[model samples]
Target chain A: AQSVTQPDIHITVSEGASLELRCNYSYGATPYLFWYVQSPGQGLQLLLKYFSGDTLVQGIKGFEAEFKRSQSSFNLRKPSVHWSDAAEYFCAVGVFGNKLVFGAGTILRVKS
Target chain B: EAGVTQFPSHSVIEKGQTVTLRCDPISGHDNLYWYRRVMGKEIKFLLHFVKESKQDESGMPNNRFLAERTGGTYSTLKVQPAELEDSGVYFCASSQTGLGSSYEQYFGPGTRLTVT
Candidate 1:
């Protein structure tokens, strides 16, 4: 079945440190990949998406993700972590015009 | 434009009772979707609506769940005879269209429904 896997359930990173969250997906065909963030009691916010062309995608709040077709992975990255960046992140995969299949989500805890 | 909006930030009802959820998509968005997430589970797709039509209801759980979008504007999801397993968060999302590869979904704050 088509599904997304977020290997890490919780990650801890100090402020000003770099962070990376791993994500892998399984699908029969080329899929649309996306990264979203959900703060406590807030709605899911789109971080970035990779449809086609240019494997490297940048998003708001200094977030970026790279799509690797060979690995079937779309990992989220950030060069510098901030206290406000701590939140739950979800990786999703979907076909065009369809519902997204999301992963279990990764929680980032920022420590100062 | 305002983002996707859902009614009743929280709802609590007894098992076997019926509950209805409402969603108002973006002003010009023609595609809407419903999703749910149980505790400690992934967010799963429930159904998809293109305009006033039901494009895909493959993920819907059962017949007790009925979704309707009249006039292609706001949408409603009625869950009749709710079960204890239905205690979770229901999210509503919308997109401009469901064609091509541009399926960016703008989500709402979600309604936390608890069936005791």
Candidate 2:
């Protein structure tokens, strides 16, 4: 069984501040990792995904995540936060081609 | 292109009542999945349908939950005798075949089901 853990339940950062959301996973082998964001009254949107490639993967909306195999972590990061970046973020781990296991999710609050 | 779409953006039902949620996947997508997010809990998978056949349903919580996809187009998930714990947001996602490294699942806005 695969599982994901997001340490932070909520985080507040000022606009233009750097932000990082922690994510750790437990899997038997190298797993597929993904970051998704959900705005109010919206569906989850893929931020980025990590399969087998460079450690750092870039995604839309100026978001990026690094896959650290040793630490079993894939934390999402953004250089500068904007007010529009306030949303709920989720980290998910995919098992083979089966279902995905998601983290508890972290709510991001951007303060101006 | 239009994303996945679900019906009845919000539904309020009573305990012991029945609620059916509909999901229309992206055109040409062969894989459709159902997931639910209970309050303060992680989103959990319910089932997966490959066209008209169910590929995997190990995540279904109980037998009371029934999901079907006819003509390999749209899918319906019906819960008979709904319980208060069943209150949550039901989300539908779809992905095309050979998703490769970009195995991204397109999602629907989800239907909020409230069982009071």
Candidate 3:
């Protein structure tokens, strides 16, 4: 079955440090990859998406993700972490038409 | 433009009671989806509605859950005889375009359901 996996359940980083969140997906064909972030009391916001073309996609809030087909991965990255960046991030793959298969999100903690 | 909006940010109800969650998509969006995330679990797709039609409901758990989008406007999800295991954050999302690069879905603040 097609599925998405976010290996790290939680990650902590000091403010201004680089951040990377890993995501792996298993799919028969090239899937539509996406990154979504959810704050404590907010909705899931679209960070970035990879449908076709441009392996690296830019999203809102200074977030970007690279889709590596060979590795079957779409990892989210940010140059510097902000205290406001502490949130739960989800990686999802669109399959079977328009539905999205999501990974068990990873929670990020930004330390001072 | 207004984003997707869900009613009742949180709901706490008895196990056997029925609760209904409502979602109003962006004014022109025709595609709406329902998802649920159990505590410490991945968010799972519950169903999808294209306009007023049931596009896909393969992920719906059982018959106890009924979802409807009347007149392709706002949608509603009603859980009858809610179970203890039904406690989770229920999210509703809407996308403007269909099966294209514009498939980016806009999500609403999820309705947190707690069945006691």
Candidate 4:
């Protein structure tokens, strides 16, 4: 079965500190990976996506993700943590061009 | 370009009742999808519609959930005889069709449903 695993349930980091949320997926084939963020009372927003080529993908809000095929991981990273960046992050894999299968999600807590 | 939108940002109802949620995808988008998140858990896929047609309904939890797209325009999901387990935030997303891998879904604010 194809599934996404986000190992961390909650993470806390000081403001200006670097952040990395781990994500590993189990899929049978090369999959379309994506990172989405849902801020408080807001809709899910696309952080970054990886279809193919150039493993490292950049997205909005100073966020970036690298797709490691060998590891079956597409972890999300940010050089600096912002208070506004604290939200629930989800890792998803698109299958058959029809729908998305999402991970359990990681909650980031930015502490000042 | 307006993003996808869902109606009744929040709905509170008793169990065994009916609730119908609506979604209006971004204009010109050919694909619309429904998802549900229970108590802030993983957002699970519910179904998919391609221009008024059901492309995939495998994700639907049970037959109590009925989704429809009118004339390939806006869409609605009706959950009849709601159960306590059905309480969650229902989300709707939309995307355009592309040749290769162009499945970027734009989501809505979501409708929070509370069943008692």
Candidate 5:
């Protein structure tokens, strides 16, 4: 079974600060990784995905994630996070095209 | 274009009651999915529908849960004799195609099912 781990449960940062959310996965073969964001009382929106080829993947809303095979990590980053970026972020690993194992989310709070 | 749409944005039912959640996928989308997030837990896949067919339902937890996607346009998940553990946000997502990496699922504002 594939599983994902997100170390941070909550993170607080000042607005306009750079941010990084860590994600690690455990899979035997090559992994398909993704990052998703969710606001309160809403559904998830995909931030980005990494399947093959490039290690660095860019996503919507100025978010990016890098897949590191050696460390089994796909960390999401934003150079400058706006107040609107505050949300619960999830990391996931998919296999065989059907199910996805998600990580416990990291709630990001932006301070003004 | 409208993204996925789920009906009954919120539902509160007593334990042992029955509830059904509906999801209307985008037109022309062939792939539809059901996922849920329990309190303080990560979202988990419940099933997948390719048109009206159940392509994969391995994630479905038990017999009390039923899902259908008749006619391939919309899908529904029903829970009979709901348990407290079933209280959570149920999300529906759809993509144009299921075979390729281009299938990025667009999600609907979930239906929060609260079992009292």
Candidate 6:
């Protein structure tokens, strides 16, 4: 079965500090990976996606993710954390134009 | 372009009552999908529609749930005799047809359903 794993249930970072949220996936084939963020009382927003080609993919709001095929991981990173960036982040995987299978999300908290 | 929209940002109902949720996809999007996130669980796919046609519905949990898309426009999901376990945030998403980059799905603000 295809599955997405987000290891960190909750993470805390000082505002302006570097941040990284880990994700791992299990799929039988090359997976279409995605990162989505949901702010409080808001819809999920696409952060970035990796279909193929470049291992490192850039997304909106100064976020980026690198797909490590060997590790079956697509970890999200940001150079600096902003208070507004605090939200629930999810990692998802899809195959062959199918619906996405999401991971248990990780909650990020930015402290001033 | 307007984003996908779902009706009734929140709904509270008795366990045995019937409830219907509606979704209007982004204009011109050919693919529509339904998903739900139960408490302490990952968001899971409920079903997918390709222009009013049920493309995939393997994710639907049980027989009491029914989904329909008429004339390939808007869609509705109805739950009869709802149960407490059904309480969750229901999300609808839409995307254009094609491969690779075109497959990116745009999501709507979900409807929170609470079964009392």
- Give per-residue CA lDDT, model 2, range A63-99, as digits (tens): 9999999999999999999999999999999876657
Worst 10 residues of 2 chain B by lDDT: B97-106
Q: What is the Å distance of residue B49 in model 4 from its true position?
A: 0.4
Scoring only the A-chain of each prediction against the true A-chain gives TM-scores of: 0.97, 0.97, 0.98, 0.98, 0.97, 0.98
The value of fnat for model 4 is: 0.70
Poorest 10 consecutive residues by lDDT, candidate 1 chain B: B95-104
- i-RMS, every candidate? 1.5, 1.8, 1.3, 1.6, 2.1, 1.4
Each prediction's whole-model lDDT (CA): 0.93, 0.93, 0.94, 0.93, 0.89, 0.94
Task: List model 6 lDDT by residue over A1-112, tens digit each.
Answer: 8899999999999999999999999999888999999999999999999999999999999999999999999999999999999999999998655689999999999999
DockQ of each: 0.74, 0.68, 0.77, 0.71, 0.60, 0.74
Q: List, residue by residue over A4-89, the lDDT tens digit for candidate 4.
A: 99999999999999999999999898889999999999999989899989999999999999999899999999999999999999
Name the runs in model 6 displaced over 4 angstroms.
none
Evaluate residue B21 in candidate 5 and report its C-alpha lDDT on the 0 to 100 scale: 97
Q: What is the lDDT of candidate 6?
A: 0.94
Q: After superposition, how far is residue B67 of candidate 1 from its true place, in Å?
A: 0.6
Evaluated on chain A only, model 2 obtains a TM-score of: 0.97
* Poorest stretch of ten by lDDT in candidate 4 chain A: A92-101
| Residue ranges of candidate 2 with Cα displaced over 4 Å | B99-102
Model 3 chain B TM at 0.96
The candidate that achieves the highest DockQ relative to the unseen native structure: 3
For model 1, what is the alpha-carbon lDDT of residue B18? 99
- Root mean square deviation (Cα) for candidate 2: 1.1
Give lDDT: candidate 2, residue A108. 100
Query: Global CA lDDT of candidate 2, please?
Result: 0.93
